[model samples]
Target: MRVTLKLATSLDGRIATGSGESKWITGEAARVEGHRLRAGHDAVMVGVETVLADDPELTVRLPRSDEIRQPLRVVLDSRLRTPATARLANPGTMILTAAEPRPVGTAEVERVEAPDGRPAPAPALEALARRGCASVLIEGGGQVAASFLGAGLVDRLEWFRAPILLGGDGRPCVAALALAKLADAPKFRRVSAEPVGDDLWERYDAIR
Candidate 1:
């Protein structure tokens, strides 16, 4: 299976301002494209921080429809810190915990389930791939996204560049890497770039 990384950020590469206030950072076109992409995925994954901060449902919906495409939601709560009230605790979801989790309701629980004792995402991802999840979409804050990028597990990328410049202190939308590490950089060939209000929707492929 393939894992695709998706995110929207300010042109200055900030996911959120220093105050942690951000919404609608991308234009309508970017959101629409995101929904369309979601329609094709079997599941979506996010970190515990994202679940607490955003509480996203990760459903695919269009303007004219009341129904939504529900995918198996996976949470990367390495220490099982996710609260009971989080949206991901609802049915049709899987709670992947590295350790025993708190009693967070009766929703089905799936352990990290890796061949090795390691709880790193790559093995969990491979398990998902074996389950016929052709692609996994990762919608998250910087840390989770950075983990995949650093490991070279990302097969594709979709980034929306907002017009605003939050400047330096804003949390960087992407994680950091050493300059020498870039020698193994993933090749991204731009597939599309169109203006979305003051923002720009960009799509890339990991051709290398």
Candidate 2:
């Protein structure tokens, strides 16, 4: 599957404030652009922490049109921490957990073995592929994005950087990775860059 990691961060690459406040990192145009990207994907995935913190309605909400398609919402909740009251528990949501399967309200549940006690992305991708999902857009908090990038699973990137700055105490766009040297980092080739309101929309292809 073609996986794209979409992120909106401050000028310093901080996605949220020190206390996790990230409601308006980017402007309305940037949000519309993000929804457009979501419409182009077959599925959208996020970690459970995001569901708990952001309570995002993952459905694509664009201008009323016959061509718009809402991608499947998938959550990687290893321990099945996604509560039944979670917004993503609504109908058509898919949850991949490492624990025993259980009915998650209207959401579909799938069990995937965790590699090294963490949710493994390969199994989730395989499952999505079997379900005929050719593309996936990963909208995450931090750790989830890092996991995909660390595993070399991300094929593309859509980054929206606002003009504001968030210092070191703020949350980063990507969480920590176990890189021993600079050469171990994931590289990407810049494909395009454009202005979206006061924010900058940047696109890149993973240099695998």
Best candidate (score: TM-score): 2
Reference-based TM-score, model 2? 0.97
Clashes of 2: 0
The CA-based lDDT of model 1 is what? Answer: 0.76
**RMSD to true structure for each model, in Å:** 2.6, 1.1
> What Cα-based lDDT does every candidate model obtain?
0.76, 0.91
Put down candidate 2 lDDT per residue, 118-165, tens digits, no spaces: 579898899899888999999996989999999999999999999999
Residue 160 lDDT (model 2): 98
Residue 28 CA displacement from its true place in model 2, Å: 0.4
What lDDT tens digits, residue by residue, belong to model 1 across residues 77-157?
767767788777777666676776566665456577443342567776876776667788988878778777777788888
Worst 10 residues of 2 by lDDT: 61-70
TM-score of 1: 0.87
TM-score of each: 0.87, 0.97
